[model samples]
Target: MNDYLVKAVAYQNQIRAYAVNSTATVAEAQRRHAAKPTATDALGRSMTAGVILGAMLKGEEKVSVKINGGGPLGTIMVDSNAKGEVRGYVSHPQTEMEINEVGKAVGMNGLLTVSKDVGLMHPFVGQIPLISGEIGEDYTSYLSKSEQTASAVGVDVLVNSDSTVKAAGGFIIQLMPGADEEVLNIIKDRMKVIAPLSSMISEGSTPEQLLEHVLGSENVTVLESMPVRFQCQCSVDRITNAIISLGSEEIQDMIETDGHAEANCHFCNEFYYFDTEHLQALKEVAL
Candidate 1:
């Protein structure tokens, strides 16, 4: 099934929840970056959480998640908007390690930073030390400490024997400010008994089913559902604009020295090549 996310409220709107099925979305990132199993899990989990966080916003708002856990995976970065579009990459996509070792591969010594751009003069940024190096726990810590919301986050990615992603998804459950202790206890109890998220995803569970599993079918009231996918905002025109901003001197230098200019987007791994003729055109525009 195509990837998608669902927003819902449970226990008479006392709890806010978001869930996503990100299998295809993560598969795209794995294919683009050629990420190994460990890197795939790290990137997939972060992207899953990032997209759900994005769904919390409105209009043109967006969020960016950055994780550097001081391990072999290096850095994992993901960007997502309220539209359910997301893109991400890992610094060392080829890092080799056993599956389900994302914590060790990601280490426990760095930080997870979230920046939200809500059309403000400056984006709001929050940073918290990594509590577990596991993407889900780190995000849970980030939400509780940075956003000051009591939240439970569960993110998982299952990798096949061939390094392809078998399933990738996650859920975020947050308690509203007026939530009662009984509601909190019930949620905590339910969380302790739910099947592993990876297993549920591998079994073809939908985002709605995932939420029902955690929040109970009777309690969850679906709010909105939207398709989500791997979507990079990079394009040749944007790259061209960046080059034009470098000034005519820089464009001329590229034409004289290299005969061509090539730029690769880190998020999508797409290359933009500008032949000498293209450089001349941009130089004129720069002038």
Candidate 2:
């Protein structure tokens, strides 16, 4: 199924929940980046979290999660917006490790740091140390410390030995201000039978379906639903601007020595080539 997410409120507007099944979405990243099992798991969870958080924003506003885990995977970056668009990449996509006791990839290290930068009246940045290299723990840490809210986040990704994603997705639940004791107790009770989140997503279930299972169908209300996918905003023009930014000297060097320069986007790895003539033209503009 195509990857999509849903946003809604439950428990009579006492809880905010987000759910998404990103099997195909994460699969695309795995295929494109050729990520190893552990890297695939990390990237998949971060992107899933990016989509859920992206749903919380409004038009032209978005959030970015940068995880510098200082592992073999290096940095994992995710970009997402309220419109349900998100893109991400890991610095090194090919790194393998053993699965943990709960079938979660233990990754290169247990250390991670997830940070969020929001564009508000004044841009704000918040960060938290990851409790588990498993992204959900890191995100949960971010919300509790940075946003100062009680949140439960679960992200799951199952990869076959061949490195294809078997399932990928996650859920985020936030307790609103003045949440009562009954609500907390209800959530704890429901957590008992929810199963691994990605498994439900892989079974061709929708985000709404997952939430209905978690919060009881009677109390669920869909506020909005959107079709989201693995999207990248990079383009040839952006690469061109980057090339131009290198100043005239660099452009001249490429024109004289290499005949042309090929630029690869870090996000998509799509190659952009500037032939010698194009380089000379850009240099003239720089002059």
Candidate number of the best lDDT: 1
TM-score of each: 0.97, 0.90
Candidate 1 lDDT over residue span 64-159, tens digit each: 999998999999999999999999999999887744688988988999999999999999999999998989999999999999998989999998
Scored by Cα lDDT, where does model 2 land? 0.78
Top candidate on TM-score is 1
lDDT of 2 by residue, 1-287 (tens): 67778888888788888988888878888888888888888888899988988888777777888877556677888888887888888887866666422213434344444333455466567766656566787888788888887887878888887999999887888887877657856875787778888778767768888888788899888887787788888887877888888899988888888899997767666778888888888888876
Give the C-alpha miss distance for residue 115 in model 2, angstroms.
5.8
Weakest lDDT window of 10 consecutive positions for candidate 1: 94-103
Model 2 scores a TM of 0.90
Off by over 4 Å in 2: 100-122
